[model samples]
Target: MKLYTWLSAPNPRRALIFVAEKAIDIDIEEASDPDNPGQLSKRYCEKYPHRRVPLLELDDGDWIAEAAAVCKYLEALYPDNPLFGRNAKEAALIEMWDRLAEWEGLMAVSEVFRNTHRLFVGRGLAGYDIQIPQISELAERGKLRLGRFFNKIDERLDQNEYLAGDIFSFADITALCAIDFSLSRKLIIPENCCNVKRWYQAVSERPSAIG
Candidate 1:
């Protein structure tokens, strides 16, 4: 199996970090567009129509596109570390928190970046080559939503060590990547969110986080 990734991207980083935490051995390919540098390569786009990063190409010629799905595939194959949780209840909790982190935090951060960054001026949305105009109002709204997300997570973190509970699961990984990605937009944990700051410090110190 092979994993195609763009290390600079936050979504791909989540998968990469999960792999590191699990200590899985797999062929890893760094993806890049020869013509556009940071964009997906033309040949890669042709091979994978969806054109998503952190893609997992199976030995059976099957492919998993989403980053979380990629991690799930890997976890099923290598279940030693058990990032998805060890039981049914744990799995549901992890999945629920992971979805919250992805939609509320990561998507919000991407919303601001896609609509405000010059690199995405004409391509505000991903997975398409067509011109999709950026809306400045969306960026402002994203910032507001992200702020609310941070506050909500802060309250949750106050009672537990990790996003889903006491265990450092995939939800923590997604939330970590989201918070780091938000830094590019000058968005950060509010000073009043002491619990979030504490959680960030602990998670960022992990060896997997460096990957």
Candidate 2:
């Protein structure tokens, strides 16, 4: 199997972290930057029409595009270090928290960065052809929503060691990537969020986090 990914991208980082946690070895291919029209080679465009990174190509020639789906596929293949969940109820809870982290946390941070950053002036959303104009009002709203999301995560971590519970599952990985991505936009985790800070420190020290 071969994984197509970009080292600096948040989505690919999530997949890399998952692969690291599982201690699996897979060939990796870095995708060229789509931002540079000259560098957007025809071969890459034909292989990945959506122009998204962190895509997993199976040995049988099947391709998995989304980050969550790629992680799920890895989990299913390597059940020894199960990150999704062990049972039905645990799976549901993990999925719920994962979705919350992606929609509330990751999407919020992306909204602010993409809309306000000059690099994305003509291309705000990902995996789509339509170009959306920057909206300062939406950027402000995104910042506010991100603050609330951080507070919610801090509150959750205050009671539990991890997002779903005691175990460090895929939800924690999702939150970790999202929180780290916010730092690039100068959205530091508040000092008052001690629980979140503590949790982050622990997760950051893990070997998989380095991936």
In TM-score terms, candidate 1 sits at: 0.97
Q: Which stretches of candidate 1 lie over 4 Å from their true place?
A: none
Alpha carbon RMSD to native, model 1: 1.0
Residue 140 of model 2 has an lDDT of 90
Model 2 TM-score?
0.93
Give per-residue CA lDDT, model 1, range 19-114, as digits (tens): 999999889997887667768888888989887788999999989999889999889899898999989999999999999999999999999999
For residues 107-198, write the lDDT of model 2, one tens digit per residue: 89888988888778876776655677888888898889889988999999989999988889889988999999999889999889999999
The local lDDT score (0 to 100) that residue 102 gets in candidate 2 is 89
Worst 10 residues of 2 by lDDT: 33-42
74 Cα displacement, candidate 1 (Å): 0.6
